[model samples]
Target chain A: MEADELLVLVAAGDQKAFEDLYGLVSGPVFGLVRRVVRDPAQSEEVAQEVLLELWRSAARYDPGRGTALAWVLTLAHRRAVDRVRSARAAGERELRMARRANGPAFDQVAEEVEAGLEREWVRRCLDRLTALQRQSVTLAYYDGYTYREVAERLSLPLGTVKTRMRDGLTRLRDCLGGVA
Target chain B: MTGFFRRGDLHSLAAPYALDALEPPEHKRFEKHLKRCDSCPAEVRALREDAVRLAWSTAAPAPAALRDRVLTAVRTTPQEPAPVRPEPLPRARPERSPSRGRRSPFAPFLIPLASTTAAAALVVAALFGVQASRAQDELAQERAQAREIAHVLAAPDARSTAGRDAEGQGIAVVASASRRAAVVTGSGLGTPAGERVHQLWLMRPEGKPRSLGLLAGDTPLVATGLGTNAISLAVTIEPAGGSPQPTTAPVVQLALKSVGFGE
Candidate 1:
């Protein structure tokens, strides 16, 4: 069933529909959270919270705004970022310092791996972006770094990072042919 | 940050805003702008769809257990009643002054002018008030979470370990014996395939391996209820959600060491 249709049922208090929605979304939600929050246990916690929020806020779902999956993923991403930011603020300075010292070289391993058609297309689109643009977008989106953080990490001006992100996403949108 | 946004600046923010890349204050400000700006909303919607595609590219199967947990929660948790959609504001129609027959031509323009002024004021007031209060609540919640983490880190007897995965991916853990909590941080672990995720495990000398949780990204993770008996920790590449048992060899393993209050 369409997520929107399922959400309509869920909004009306349909447990079965909510279950269906969960099946359709939990992976993406969890995966997205994992990408931002990194820790297995806490990722699970954040994912659970995002899903529960979905159940509670299903009534607020507006078809005019976006699809059910997008809304759910957005919520998951926000929650995951929140967890990361809060942890950073909570005296994890040593850990953050360690991470910065051992920064991951953003590689194409993720794009090279075997995947479905949609994933391949996404990778292909991402590949088309300039290295700077790709890095900026990936750092901000998948890594959950704010634009300002991305700027500091890349040692570029904040305006440059913002422009790169915006331009990169615009190109990606065009490359993906607006299918998503 | 609380000033009027130029048209170009507002339009440019649609992508970052859609991707949740903006700071909280910027995000909230853009959202308020989004409500009144027709063009930007559609742009944001499209950008969000693109992000959804990106999210789909990394789709890993969630843990089987999570399904049950979420469903159980859904069944037990009361569903919020659907919100009553607010009625659309009545259109501003010029009220005819009956006493002034054959009204001056300027009167026609005057009524709409008055109505438009009132509607604009109402919208600005309502939107600003709602957004400001919501931002404050969010800020408060964030501060609370930060305080909780601070307390955990400040606990005495906090032991920590740092190591690297086989692929040279960095992983670190800080555990507080008093709080029975630990936070794991990972880096250089690139995005896993759509079907897999890196899972962290807490291994004891004797009992079955305990799943600490799964990493979503290269961020810090908090694990609670850490057992004193856990002798070591290991991470492995497993199917998304995670596995009932380790499905692959450990990517990295580190022995837990006692500190300060010697074990």
Candidate 2:
């Protein structure tokens, strides 16, 4: 069954369907959170939280909103971003950045991403963006930087960073052919 | 993040918001914008789909035994009840439906509690600069006010607008039509000269203006029971204990657009 179908069953409290849904989604959830959060142990904790949230909020899923997969991933991404932005993690993030000489936050994580067809397609789409646009999106999404932080890290003006983020996502949306 | 984004260009924040790239304050502010911007929800949904694709591009497998940890925990975890959807309105208007059990009017706003807590902490920290030596009672009162400010900013239907007072002090208003509440914060507002106070009023299209309350310097002022007909927020100087109505012309009048109905 598709994830949408399984999610509906999960909403109805079918344990088996939830197991199936987890099997289908856990990889992407863990990967996405890990990409943003960086630390493996912390990533696992956040991934578990996202999965539990999915279980707890299954009934809140609205098919009219977007796909079940998109909803799940959005929850995961938001959770990861929140983790990175929290006060506790802020100090650790600073240390990590200093150690890495403040390079684009994606280098290590990007290399380790599984070479799946989806990964290749996304990379191709991302490659089409201008350097500044790609940097703006990745630094924010993958590295979990706020757009303002992205601007400061890139030494670009706030307005320019905001524009690049919007334009980058717009181009990516068109290039990805409207995934929803 | 509050005063920097022009009201006309808030829709531009949609993409960053969808990608989870905004700071909490900006995130809350943008969310309030989203509720009244008719086309924004669809735009955000589509952009989020794109973001989800970016998530999928990095699908590394989870640890082998972690699956059991998660599945086992799920067995004991009770699920949350789905939110009750409000009946569809014929036109855009403030939406109010309980997401869970009926909440008391004074209960802390609960839906976005985590982010609101963080934002409120920031507000409290900002207050600490000038309020550190204040009495404990005043500290408690200010904390509550900070929470109220955070609540209004964090409301799902909150919308923000900014204007300048006569002295060029920046005034920001974040209003939630669903909650019938608004929070007014100003930068560089001057203390009124002897025996007078700065006052806030909610200006309605037809009725007499309703007093919100006295504004003390730059402390955020929260006003509840905002009428749907409220057209703008006005601030004026009133004699000491505040007045039944404004005796002076508004030094700052911010037109409140995009509160509930689409612009």
Candidate 3:
């Protein structure tokens, strides 16, 4: 069954279906959380929380609303962003940024290898966006920066950044038509 | 669709909002705007589809042990109860029989009301109780109103559209044609200037606009009979008691789309 059907069963408190859902979604959930949170242990904790939340709020999932994968990823992304926005991560963010600036070869190698074919598709779509649009989209989604923070980072007007984010996503939506 | 106010300004935030890039205040503000935006939900849904692909692109295998921990937690966690979709309301005339089966969610606070007069009486009592500072009864009325709002929101066919005044104050209507009702909520309307009040009007395909009610601060107004040919919803400033007709031009006017009722 598709993820949508699995989610419906999960909503009915089907444990076996949930196990299947975990198999389908855990990698993307953990990977997205890890990208934003960056700490291995913390990412694990957040990912666990997200997975638990899916089981807890499964019934609220409306099949008419959108695809189940989209729903699950939204929950994962929001939770990851919430973690980075919290007070504890305020200090860790600078450290993560410093680490990112140094661009450790090991992390880069691991990321490139693990990213797989999905990353190739996203990278191609992303390349179609203007340089500023790509930067705005990435800094916010991957870095968990607020739009204002993105504007400051990019040295662009807040309005300009907001438009770019909207335009960029619209372009991506068109380019990746029907993929989700 | 007005030009200078940049009315679409807040609507443009749907992308950032979908990406989870908005900070708390902007996040809250945009969320309020989103509920009433007709095009926004679909737009946000599409963008989210793309956003998830971004999440998928970075997919890394989770630790094998983490699965055991999550499954263990799931075994003990109770799932939220799914929303109860109320039985189809007994069909009543769209305009005259406003309150018949509509209070299904509030049946505990109120008996299943049938007569329009009795429901009207409860509304009057609910209003007078508020004025008389009767706490317990007022509480019940508030709960009923809240549930009524929730009922419309939870309706499977609920559709939202939003409009803003020239000064940027916004109003959004979430209407469910099947329920023949709509909930109107606004942000930044601010308090009407001394003794004046904000009034709601539902314009039909023909005839003068009908007064829905007076806006009570931030409280959402639940108006029924959306199945009627109500073409647009307008808000205008009026005298404290409200006008028989709009005394002033509408500050916010959202054109209503035909929400098809499922027979």
Candidate 4:
């Protein structure tokens, strides 16, 4: 079913519509959110919230934005960032995050999101970033970090981190289009 | 990185800074520039689109059970699409309809919480009157209240953000598209002291901060209006109710814009 029709059904409480929407958009939503969140178990939980949020907010979906996929992806991004920001601020959550950063969930997420031209392109562009730049931008843009936090985390000058992020994103933007 | 600036560059590249794609003082500096720069505003839009695109880049696989979970959640929960309006009962039913339970002489007292809803309505009326009296405003000095009301009564922000409140404690709250948006109660906020209430401000990049509303003591602050088009929610310690504007500095500033909603 088309995203619009499925959304209408979702508004009407059609579980089938939700399932269909999930099948269609979940991968991108999950993948994008996972990159920022970086914890597989928590990623799954947040992704679930994002999907459920879509179901609940189906009535709010307007076709003008893009596709149902794009809409869900936006929500996923915001939620992923919120999770990271809160966890970091809470202090304890960051400790937990660091401990789990290298857990099996990352592998699982990689397995789930590893394909397609766009993904391949993003992966390639992401690879071109220096280790610190990649980590900072991934955390700052993808994870919603304040520059101060990203700088502190990487133990780099706030200025250096900022330049890395700007340059890194500019490269990604140019790679993706004439535009980030 | 500095080499990118060699080719007639003068920090014009700071437009993507909204995505935190730029660094500190420059980030602060460009923010000042964003207000007067129309071209930069358009550039900000492009950068935001890019950010949104990056968000959609690799699709992550949702849990297998997500299908079941979401479907089951939607299925089991009743959708009150419109408030259920029961069709007029098949006019003139027998007094003792067997399907609905045997009618007895004591049926008068057994209102079943529905029959006397009309009489019980007095309770609702009284409740509304009290709420109206409490929530009603007496301050005639407030300006253009209608437009402001629209901004305030908007559905309590449905979106949520993770950040720290003024006290630097963890908080999750949603800001409206503007400071006047109706705020649905979230899990944060407590009463501040006399000369110290929760002051809401819409912090524009370079412009003087516009005051949204206040979270006073006792009354639930959830429904208060937030600054719309607000980049961040800054709560300050001002006099009871709130300052005509912020008198002291912001105690907490949560940048909801970074979460990409404002984008």
Best model number under lDDT: 2
| iRMS, all models | 17.9, 15.3, 14.0, 18.0
Q: Which wins on lDDT, candidate 1 or candidate 4?
A: 1
- The model with the greater DockQ, 2 or 3, is 3
Instruction: Flag regions of model 1 displaced more than 4 Å.
Output: A93-115, B1-7, B84-263
Docking band of candidate 1: incorrect
lDDT of each residue in B33-76, candidate 4, tens digit only: 55445455444434544555466555555667866776677665
Report, for all candidates in order, the number of backbone clashes: 10, 1, 0, 22
Candidate 2's docking class is incorrect
**lDDT value for candidate 2?**
0.68
Q: What are the lDDT figures for the candidates, one per model?
A: 0.62, 0.68, 0.66, 0.50
Instruction: Tell me the lDDT of candidate 3.
Output: 0.66
Which TM-score value belongs to model 4?
Answer: 0.44
- Give the winner by lDDT: 3 or 4: 3
In candidate 3 chain A, where is summed lDDT lowest over 10 consecutive residues? Answer: A98-107
Residue A156 lDDT (model 1): 90
**DockQ metric for all predictions:** 0.18, 0.20, 0.23, 0.14
Global Cα RMSD, each model: 26.0, 22.5, 21.2, 24.0
DockQ for model 4 equals 0.14
Write model 3 residue lDDT over A94-116, tens digit each, in one string.
Answer: 53443332221124424533543
Error of 4 at B2 (Å): 26
Model 1, A1-180: lDDT tens digits are: 556678889888889898878877787788777767777788889999988978887877754444456667777877888888888778563223323312232232344322233454466678778878887787777777788778787889867887888788888765544312
Candidate 3 structure quality by residue, lDDT tens digits, B57-120: 6778889999999999888989977656411111001212111112233211122223223223
Q: What lDDT is reached at residue B170 by model 4? A: 27
